[model samples]
Target: MVNVYVLVTSVSPLTSFLHDISVVMTIQHPRGQPVKLRDFLLQHLDPAASHQALRQVKQVISKVLQAAAASTNKKLRTISRCVLCFQLLTFTLLFSSSVTPVVVQVDTQLNVSGLSNDAFDQQITKDLILEDTLHFLLPPLSHLSSHTHLSSEREGSQYGGCTGTLGISLSEDEFLLLLHFQLLMKTSSAFQPLYPSVSSSSSLPRSLSDLPDLLTQIEGFYKLKTNRSCRTDEPPRQQPALSSSQDEGLCVDPHLRQIYTDPPLILTPPFHPLVKEYRTEVTFDTMTVRIRPEPVSSACRIHLDEHRGPRMANYPVGLGNSKISILVMDGSHPEPVIMSIYTVHVYRESRPSLPMFGYHVMCSFVQDCSLLVQPGRPCGLQPHSGSQSQRNACSSGHVSGRWVVPCLSCSDNRTCDWREVSWQPDGCYHPIVDHPLLQDCMKDRKLLFIGDSTNRGMMYFLMERVNSTLEDWGKAHDTLVYRNLNRGRTLVSYSYYPQFWLEKKQRPTFRQALQQLLNRSQPLVNSNQTVLVVGGVQWLNTNHLRTVSEVLDSESLSNILVVVKSLGMGFHLPVDGIRSLSLTEIQDLYRENDDIVTTAKHHGYEVIDTFSITMGRYKEFLQGRCACHFHEVTQLYLSANEALPVVRAAGLTADVLLCFLRWRSFGPQNLPVTERPPQTRTEQRELYIHSAANQPCQTRSRTRGLNPQPIVLEDQ
Candidate 1:
């Protein structure tokens, strides 16, 4: 087989599908080994060599080839996935037979890292009219053994659910995305018929089609299984499965905080086709789990047995205990999950269970009298320590004398003396002037926050400090990013609940989200310099938090700086609000958070101790003002007897963040001691809520209600 080196150079992008990219190629092959294009390309497509242009080109080519072959090579099967990311990056149709094998031995070095969005996309259409050209890019559908089905049409409408979208223009960008998405999912299986069939006779299908119903069917199956109490193999009591159309889609609101717990139990000893696995088979007994919330608490029974395994140790779950899940940490893993169990095991019912990698956790209920603490594998503890580094607020030259700043708003100017406060010099300092060093450090970087509103606040807070001039603040929808195009190309952005589930389709799995994030970021950003924060502001319940953390505990988690903050801000419970968690419930929530933090840290994530800071400030900022959205913080009053802007809140936090950015870097360094509590502890005592006993445990609730909705949290 001959090997060829081709350089792709740019053409009119809006005109053509890809700009040609150049790379000096050196193809090294064991002599006489069959050199398929897929093998040849995989062996040579180096990011270092091609400025990452070869990435998309490689995916399209590889998927087309890999799907064509029925071989389930473990390497290939394990090649997980991401959202359908199709950018007209670079490259075009591939025909292995088309390549005239010739090798030109040459060595040259050029960096293409700056070349953004240069790669091959089979279905990325620039013009709606040019959809036909995209068809040429993909291998013909004849390559795949099966074709994907499009959802049936609604009366007089091309599109269906999220019904308003029907008759939407095909030329719209969303339509293109919807189309590409359909193609990606259809193709997602293995590499066969990645795309639906289209005719040479017509340019566009006479009728519009959306994602195949099969995708929703899978989601429906999982939804029906979430939170089910115990079941061993033999599909949980025959529930009616819905067709794709009837299934509730994955596109729940980004702000929608939901937790689905499906403790799926599988039997090791194979069961006969007709044999029924019963609750009694494993020496299991049932009992109720009583949570404080009157209605969120269900009469769900737990199944426990005393059988011990080589790795798993049984713990007796005391009745009516606050804890909701069993976190089984196998000692063999360095910082990885042995397995986990949640409410699903006790529910014996199902509803869209939280999306998790079922394969990662082997869950079965075992009865023990008390929780067992495994050595070196404590169930609920942050494993890491804080950095010794500290930058004092008193040290900064920007602060020379006593500065009085405005705090939260005051009504009727009551209690004048109580309103005036002195700036505390004990913590980190935010320098209003002379941050050139800090600017240079963060320059040319893309900082993104993807959780709920607190993360949105985080993005807003960071933007206030780094860039002097803000471009497009709060204007963009779906993704909110601060653009500093001229300086460092430093883009700071926030995505409110970053679209886990598309509008009507099923929510994407974690791997898919990771892929989309990676695709968006500049290729060079990795664990050393960036942090991917999850779980700070949404889905505080055990099931949801576990789901989010489980997703965070991914292969991508290792390569990137992963920071898992507990859900909700501890301080935000409205002092007199109609809805609020009792002190006990809050403590319980924090305890749940600690368990998640331990699991996350063991799986390689830096846990931020927000719970400590929020608890301490609960009497201050949280009760200080009943603000729901940390939309923008303003110092309402300068000081007693002085009318001015409230700069204290921002001033204090700015300094704290300043210390974080300067000394407590996200890459490899632990948080600075000043930012981290002296010690990290996970306890339910409200008095020590602010104790930093655990450097990595922080749970600041950010859910909408001051507490959970009093409404019965039964299966919808």
Candidate 2:
């Protein structure tokens, strides 16, 4: 009766009124008779409900009250079943206006003998899927590469890498489930932003001027709260040490069980299972305090007052009883179907501002793991010794697999086994571009690389590979060209972009670099033999992508191959005063990357995402260089006591070149299975050429001064 009264009077303030009413209806009356629904409404229904609640709900329920008022003069409105039915009808109408039914389909391919759709929907929610995927065990980090704890049976599994956690292997069903939810997760507003900016209205309290006695009190509370140390067992290799207070018999005081009070600090079990513990160690009179995550959870978002970021384990902590909110994707069953948000009280003794020298040390050596530790194979392509021409022997354009280094005991660690492994794409094989293959691939072709230093690096590798006599390579933002006058007669050019690479006083107008590319006179003029790869979208804006799409849409360039290189992961190192990209910055980059990929595909251009190739090997970024640059891998044929031509380019550069080769050799028909778009420029052009040949004869000039070649489809 109280619940019913509360629902009608506080309709505007009560967000969960429907849920409360449902509970009230299920309660049995003290008397052994059914509760009189008509009498109940007459006693509890308030006029304020009609004035305050949803207009549609108010109108529907008001009609029932008017009908009851018409019959109020009757002496005994006794046991009429119709009155009870009408009361339920009023609720149904109110609920119908507020709630819309959603139809759930598990999977088109999921065939089960007796599983019902409702049961499937209930069992596998969006939150459930996310929690499961985040919980999937990851391969150990690079420092733990030599740790031999992995079982012998799991030795054949594919994920292996150093330094970072980026790749993972999933079964087909798991992959489908993860992919389905990921698409939905991106559109979901249920999950809060990992690092949201603090609002002006809810400003945090001023930082403690000096180290408070609260640090000692908090530590003492933890020590006294438990009988023994919670952490006793050694954690898995490369994983942080985690332990639960419940395991140590810490009593749960009902008074302190406040997940709804100010600050919402609930320091007890029903604690987030994904993150078992958060431990803080103070040293050197609080001059260097570190907070660590004790579990293998990678998706934890840490918030300390105004400062916020994801995966902020081992970061510096300052003085005071700081309110720390750690959000992780873990099943807090029988609770809300959302990512678990836990608030813990951490006390540290230090200044809030981190010094640059200390920041560098923490980021370089002490920071055990990053916020986002993607589970999969390590960065770069794995080495393969098999014949290169076998179909099904190479990998997709985005290569996978692990590097196998043989000489671990050499005195010079740098020279220790630079090249025991050979480059191989993961699934199907295309011949490696040797001197002869290079000539055949680029014979009379024009290759243009447009973007930043990364693309320039690839051009340098190809140039050196094309001409062994070349001695030096230049690093500048200029229009430079190389022509192979002897063997293939190929022309390779590099064009820097975004106009910011130029001096401020001489910068061109917006997108002038791309505009010039399209407006320039063509020397080769043969669209069929031209290939252009545009990269460095990390610095590009949406306007740049739109301009690029226009170039791809030009009918004169339709037949040429154009590839858009996706953004790669940046490291903690700084380049030209620019530090590594923050997680928030990376999110923005991803949006731009998606726009570029969509724009590229809309105009039949190929896209190659190098994020996976560089994400896991971020630690390999040489000091004093751009955080985006990676170290080069030396090519050594140890079996034959011979060395291959030393490709001075990095692993990313080599893999990108291999991507083009794979696309050219297979021609899209034999592409390796991956989640990216299946169609390439090669396939689109082939279809166009095939269709054009069947049509009526027509004269179409390809360029200014060349014989118009008839549309022809020939077997390569």
Candidate 3:
């Protein structure tokens, strides 16, 4: 579906490569190009993805055999060859799949059109998306941090820093660089030879009059640029009130009147530099606009956009819209030049996207870009805390072959490279167990976890987060003493129940655990409020599914809400910078576990996706030192004698998931009556009857049984 264009000769117009065999062309910057496509890509594209592609493209370009040919065709072929090489390189990069391909548009003649409403809106958006943007929620601009929300949980007083929607940006280094470059081209004596003799196109710009033609001539080199014109409501020399944002390498802050090189600006999110919301109050033309309230974090209202994808609530002008703008409104000039200093390109997600709701504000300033521009900038790496023998723990190398760059994540234990690092609420993360409301719900109930040692270890991680007292209550049927007494009455226990494995590993059999789960002999304790988390996929054999099927058949399945945890990532071999396991082996293992996840979901069991949790480079799981990327936690505790670090890393990610786990252990009925919303008499009667109908001690008919297959194990 992608149209391949070709330019056979310098003078030839673009033609489809499929239409003519001789129309092969290389990517070129035409004389009248509007933007610097190459420079923009090189500056904004992720360094990790760019590095991977550049390495591959270099190899391919080096290997392309050369031969004699017509001058025009030879040049065209070279360009075409390199384009092919780069595309192939990016194909590999697509595994990460966040980077988007840039498409450049060029016109031989000056292309101008009357701006339509849509076009005008697009221009306004592109103009206002400056370095210090305000797309997401934020607190008011006061120095007070209390009003500010992290993940959107706080809402308080509001204010106005800017009105009339007249946005001026706090231009960053890259923007300043363009200004500095053009300024130098005009004044620097060293550039005298480059200027053509007295032609209209070559005339020096006394002001902004001669820029368009001059830019057209310069467009043949740098490809990344935008044709932003400077013109707006003017008042000479008034101080502009744009949100202040500071980037690395730039000497001048945008708040002051100065000029310097603009470092490259990256607007991609959730990686874009974090800009806190600024609050202020201003009366514009007797219209005292009331800005919406927010905190460090709050629940963002969800609305279906045109594509039906979930977007934060939209509002009118000067309101709390999910956007921020920074522009330099230089009022000091006689005729103030209003340079629209921003650009935002939103890529539409494909249809049938998974729906998500709720968000909380998180805050952090953009890390100083000096780390990038300044070479060997002294990486203050910290050693991971570890075992007694290695108290210092200063070793740069890891126990396994995984070479994670420590400077990337734990940089001085203060700064990080990513713009906004956080765990999205819906993406395998949740609220904690100690919520004021959840605590009241758990007072009269208990929480039970049934899984292997990995899941048990995850319990330990969760135990740290939710302060609970541990106990060793070894019972006969479920003999493991993996027990915790939280809030005295609420008992949390992990019993080793390796499904389908009857072999003596000195733990209870799966059948014994199931019998205990059903409480066939004893009355079900706190049957209504109790919660069960099941995870035995790692140990399930091919035919072991029958055992699980039988367990699900019991009356306990319908009476209680069950939760399943997906299998953690396994390393079969090294692939895609992760040296832990083979690609095919890991995929095969995940594929097998997918059946477990599928069955659990099919039976209406809530599945906690551990796969996405382990994947690296997501906002919370930053590019480096993540579970999949570098085995971070494993690096802390892994030793040379261990099998490998991948196992430990996988365990650690599961542990992290526990931190994100919500107290969904009890249903709505378990909520303390004081906190529970009131129901009418009729509604309460219906609920009372419903609960009475599903009594646990009662028996059910055996006529309705699932048809599980026979235990055929000959292949083994």
| CA lDDT, every model vs. true structure | 0.32, 0.37, 0.29
Off by over 4 Å in 3: 1-421, 425-429, 432-438, 468-478, 481-484, 499-509, 516-528, 540-546, 555-557, 573-581, 617-716
Cα lDDT, model 2, residue 117: 36
> Which model, 2 or 3, shows the larger lDDT?
2
lDDT (tens digit, per residue) of candidate 3 on 396-427: 10011110111223534333212112222211
* TM-score of each candidate structure, all chains considered together: 0.31, 0.36, 0.29
- In model 2, the Cα lDDT at residue 400 comes to 41
lDDT of 2: 0.37
TM-score of 1: 0.31
Q: Write the per-residue lDDT of candidate 1 for residues 445-546, one digit (tens) a residue.
A: 556556654555555545544554333344222455445533755665554453533663665544454445544654545454665555544354345445
Per-residue lDDT, model 3, residue 512, is: 64
Query: What's the lDDT of the predicted structure labeled candidate 1?
Result: 0.32
Which candidate would rank higher by TM-score, 2 or 3?
2
After superposition, candidate 1 runs with Cα above 4 Å error: 1-434, 475-477, 482-486, 498-514, 538-557, 570-579, 619-658, 664-716
Question: Per-residue CA lDDT of candidate 2, range 340-387, in tens?
Answer: 445554443321222121111101011113424332322222222332
Q: Model 2, stretches more than 4 Å misplaced?
A: 1-396, 399-426, 485-488, 499-506, 518-521, 541-543, 552-555, 574-576, 587-595, 631-647, 662-716
Clashes of 3: 55
